[model samples]
Target: MGVSDLLSLIGLFLAIIAFLDSSERKFILNKFSNRDFFLVSLYLILVNYLIFYQWWTNQIEFLNYFEFEGFPNTNTWAYFISIILIFWFLYKIMYAYFPNENKDKVLQFYKYLIAKKEYQSLFSYIEKYDFKKLRSKKVDSFQVILLEEIIGNKLFLKETASYNFFFIIELLNTNDNKVLENNFIYSQLTDQNSYTLMNIESPNQSFFKLLFHNDEFFLKSIDHNLRHNMSDLILLNKYILKFYLFTSQKKIVENTEVIENVFLKIIELKKIHILNKYFSNFSKTIVFDNNNSDSFASLFDLIVNQLNQSLIVFENNEELKFSFNIILDFSLNHYEKPYLKTKVIQSLTTKIDSENFIEFRKSLYECWRKSKKENESFNNNIIEKISNY
Candidate 1:
């Protein structure tokens, strides 16, 4: 190949690399409008045509059969177009690989807004920008800077502006290291203090619904926070439970480790209300799969052990009775038939004593009666075992 042919080949190669890198690394294509795509396509076609026209005419003999009476001469523009396209491709590749320019511009704009306390404009800008079009790292940087500004100013804590902050947070990508690393941002997203700050009396079930669609992402965040001990488990455990319950209703909890981790924390904290909420929701939404018997057994044992602990620890009879009813409801609703053979009934009833033993039996019977008709055999087996106990 001649020098011109080699240069054209390199240009084509660079263009292809730029396109692919932008598509994968920067997600630049997602930001492109239809007009931008059309222009890009036209430019590529023109460049490719200039690069290959002479080669195709010379290298391939079949073109001799065509009428080239009015065709543009390759000598006129091929070398110049080839050189221009090469530089353009190089620029694109560099932009895709190192997108700091765009990120810096965005950060500067946001800083200006924050400096001027243009809270409304800042929120509008955030609302208008498509975060998915940006690289995750850029989005993460934006979140860190924005969060620092908000927390520093205490801008969003006011009753009038709190919802705006929450709304902006809802738009942010939750699966980011920077956002998670910022303790105040992490607390606002996953802690109970968020509700109090927002003046919400209860956990908003759909608060995280929009932020987390992937089960693994949500689970990993929970696991990471718990593992690092970054969160106040006492204040956040209920919100965590609420998030799990919300996710359970929307989708299956696929990662058992995260589920186990969260549950262990809840049990460790002895948040009976959260536990009751979890069991109540688990019974309704999660099916007990015999295939995952080991996991089921582990989780069951943890909860049962907690219940045994509750029996001794809880001074309030009503709280103890509430716990009993919740566990009974969960067990009877989900466990399969021949409950004695399954070891579920035995593990549950093992802690019953002469005092609340009558209450436990009554709760068990009530749960049996409340259970679905198809669960009669399972409930009957549980009741028979309890009578023998």
Candidate 2:
């Protein structure tokens, strides 16, 4: 009826409306400024005083019921009760809304990807569904490409893809080694992945940072379980880069053109490794049908050409030896029959006649000789092909 009653009613209405609004939780603490707090406190005190005065003078029935022998002011008790009820109501409303808010769709989707073992689709999946929520403003295409390589490599290995893994590469102002080192330390605690391509002691610190620290902040912002994993593929790809492309002492000065070239080489080597892994099997030889043979043949030619070009930069014989063994393994693994095996051997002998090939040839010759000694008829044609070469 009076201004105090009107103000109290308006306050009650606002409090109830706030309780009904879902987004009020975000603003509840922010809604009260120092001025708002002082005003509300003064208003409650004034209203309580007015009620006590009116009740004492008029002897109101309901007001007299709350009287006591002690100095327990009824209007003061009423004011406290009203404030407590407002807070209790807000608390109940917020509790009901918060649990539903915590059921974040993006987080659930990431967990789903991990459980389904769809690791290779992780980057695209995030980009398609939850990019805005998960991606940092500094994220770049290189980081995404690097993540793709990390997850895609799982397809080549027997290991299960991990959900708790993060991939970070320092791309910005890579001239700073200290910054790269700091990021490396952070990535370790976060990534459950057993292997990381990050080379802390790399002499080419600048480039190492570029290759390993491109999306440091972006990666760290993502959920650790969603982001961290045993980055085997990228690490293997980095092994090729660290050993083959970045072998020079002056790699620190290598320009973008050189870095881009190295990336192309890394991609090519990955392609070769993929072909070797898919086609070569100790368990059974792949029967290259017309459907697959064309693809197989193209990958085979690409591998041979890449290996030939590798001879220029490969300083270590063991590196080329490993490459030769991969080729030999694939050649031997894909052919079960003697003629098919011999045919692969012949093709290999033509491409593999260097000094390195001779050592590899002798090793194959001994293996065949050992097999022949065990059975006297293990595959005479393969031994003959090696001997002729």
TM-score of each: 0.39, 0.32
State residue 116's C-alpha deviation in candidate 2, in Å: 38
Q: Could you give candidate 2's per-residue lDDT for residues 36-147 as a string of tens digits?
A: 5576677667665555666555765576564558864555655655676567545543432212233343244444555656554554443332334224445343334333
User: How many pairs in model 1 have backbone atoms within 3 A of each other, for residues 3 or more apart or on separate chains, i.e. clashes?
Assistant: 0
Who wins the lDDT comparison? Answer: 1
lDDT of 1 by residue, 37-84 (tens): 576677657666655766777887887676367876654465566567
Per-residue lDDT for 386 in model 2?
61
Give the Cα lDDT of each candidate: 0.51, 0.42
